[model samples]
Target: MWEVRLAKHLKADLGTDTFDLVQVPTPEPAAGEVLVRTDYLGLSVAYLEMLRADSRLPIPPWEVGQRIGGGAVGTVVRSNSAELAVGDLVRTMAGWCEYSTGPADQYPGLDPDLFPSPVHYLSQGPTAYYGMSEVAKAGAGDVVFVSGAAGGVGSLAGQIATCRGAAKVIGSAGSQAKIDYLVDELGFDAAFDYHDGPVLDHLRELAPEGITVFFDNVGGEQFDAAVEAAAPGARFALCGALATQIGDHEDRFPEPDLTAAAAKGIAVLPFSTYHTPEQVAAWTEHFSTWLSEDRFVFPHTIVEGGLSAAPQALVSLLKGSFKGNVSVRVAS
Candidate 1:
């Protein structure tokens, strides 16, 4: 077995020099433990940002030779716990490894029938569910705007808003193809390419009446634009800030001018999965129902070469070079 580990803390650019693919002896299950054979690994922008020396996340800086942690779905090849059996599908935070052995409590069993593709649990399910329903409180007849609308969470957020009965859903993406995807496939009322014009201008053109709800994924100029175009008493869900993830620590994300927000009685709420475990179970059940009913659509960009490709895949995602959820296949 092999695992991908950090070779060194990243600088401005990340590459092979920042990672090491090392062979390791296959791990064995211990008492109350399970040995999982990894099938797929989910990449997250938050985890990528945490790998930097001066990360904005509230965690200690990553050290060299440490196993990169994110999300992984696999099968339990060996289980010493009576509660689990061989061949059980499971999800864990075991990261970029072909196989992992950990306490059974660390690897939760997932229903293959409900989650046929376990990656969806990481991609479109939990985060999108909470951000829209719980944090943003999107409702019928509300006009919603989603920034970074082509990426995994944003894409799902838009679709979820539509399903939640938003009067109109507007999206902003980095490319024309993504804009087309949002409008044509995801049922977005309108979408724009952020590169084509100033973000505020694009928002003004796409949503002249102003949006009642804002789902913010990219927090730079897009955030400013959304604030400028927000309706009276509008709600803003502050999600990930992709701009700050790529920029140096000294580079601050653009703050929305509060004068307009205050005048309009707008509310801005920042949320994260870390503070909302109760929402996870509720949203997961809802997401599974939505998936079965075909009320939700999730698109992912899969990178081949298994664990070896993970580092670069994450780099591409942080650089905004890929669309939708990014995942790596570790085994069949």
Candidate 2:
């Protein structure tokens, strides 16, 4: 089995060199275990923070030489339990590896026919849906704004806000192409490139009346700007800090302004999606239904070259080289 592992605890820099993809003896399934071959690996910004030497995320940090764990979908090639059968598709936390061995229950069976492609299931949708629908509670009459709206969770968060009936959905991105993608492809009411001018100025112009729901993905300036542009009592569903999550970012963990939000009575709620079974179920149910209803767009990008390409794919993801949900096809 081939797997990528942390070469060392990350310090000031992160790149493809940070990982080592090596071959190991494939593990055999125990009496109650199953052996699965990796097919697709989901990449998210969460992994960037996890790689750092001092990570603030609630999740534990990875140790040197540890297997890089993440979301993955694969086929059960060998099974010793009744929970799953050979050739059945499943979602697992056994990412970055060509093969995995675990209890049958850990790799839950998934119907391959559910999504248009296995790639579709590799998403940050649980977080996106949780923030927009639950935390922000976006709905009709709400003027919703999403920061870093071209990335995985942001892309879906903006669209989820729209589906939940936000009267207007506005998004902020890094470039004109991403702005166009948000508005034209994802159905945002308006989209702006933060690089065009002051983020505050962009927000004030696009959401002049004041935004009632702020689905924030990029923190720092965008959070400050959103606080300034928010209507009284607006809900801020704090999701990601893409601006600082990058390894090379200066002030990679800058504190977002909360005092001003308090003075303005805007609800600043920061939450994390643990991707529990309930969360996965809620998102997949809504996602499938929304796609069937033709009211939602599943924006995604799949990187080829299997497991060996996974490291570079993750590096590119953090550098904003791709859009929407990102995944690596680890196998055919």
Candidate 3:
């Protein structure tokens, strides 16, 4: 079996060299345990925060010489308990490894036929659903804005807002192609490229009267812009600060302009998706129903190459080289 371990803390610009790949003997499943084979490994720019030396993320940072952690879906190749069958599909947190032996309860079983593919289960549906639908309360008669809207959670956030009946859902991405994909494919009413002009100008033009809901994924300039463009009594769901946490170490945390927000009476709700069973169940219910009704599109990019490719996949994800949800296909 092969596994990837953190070689050192991440620097400003990221690369595959931050991790080391090595071979390890596959451990045999013990009593009440199962041996699982990696099938799909989930990727997210949020992993950048977890790789930092002094990470402020709710979860602990990945330690040097230890296997990295992320989401994954796999199949049981050997089972020693009645909880899971040999071919049962399960979701696990034992990432960056080709195979793992763990207690049957550690890897919860998932319905293989519930989604179009296993990759759909890899999306950040819980975070997106919670932030947009619950925190922001986006619904009809509201103009919604999502920053970094082309990335994993942001992409789903925009679509979830639309699914919840937001009057108009707007997004900001890094490229025109993403903008087109957001509006044309994801059913967003409008989208803009943050690189083209001042985000404030773009937001003001997109939502002339002012945005009523902001699902913030990137915090730097976009956050400031949203504060200025937010209408009175608006709502903001602060999901992440990808832009701030990416570059120079000194700029990892940026403060929001609360003075403006206070004057506008905006409800700024900062939240973390703990991915509790309740959260996962809510997202799966709505996502499954929405997909069956043909009201949603699962925008995703499947990266092929097994376990060794996982590190580079994160690099490409943060560099904006991929669109929507990204996952490494470790096996068929």
TM-score of each: 0.94, 0.97, 0.98
Count of steric clashes across candidates, in order: 0, 0, 0
Candidate that beats the other on TM-score, 1 or 2, i.e. the better one: 2
lDDT string, candidate 3, 1-332, tens digits: 89999999987678899999989999899999999998999988788888888888888999999998898999999999999999999999998898999999999999999999988889899999999888999998889999988889988998888888888889999988998999888888899999898999988888999999999998988998999999999999999888778565567886776988999899999999889999999999999999999998998999988788888888888889998999998875
Kindly state the number of residue pairs that clash in model 2.
Answer: 0
Candidate 2 C-alpha error for residue 21, in Å: 1.0
RMSD of 3: 1.1
The TM-score, computed over Cα atoms with residue i paired to residue i, of candidate 3 is: 0.98
In candidate 1, list every pair of residues with a backbone clash.
none
Query: TM-score rank, highest first?
Result: 3, 2, 1
Name model 3 segments beyond 4 Å from true. 247-250
Model 1 steric clash total: 0
Rank by lDDT, highest first.
Answer: 3, 2, 1
Q: Kindly list the per-residue Cα lDDT of model 1 for residues 35-153, writing each as its tens digit.
A: 99998898877776667877766667667898888788899988899878999988888888999998988887888887667777677557777999998999899999999898888
Better of 1 and 3 by TM-score: 3
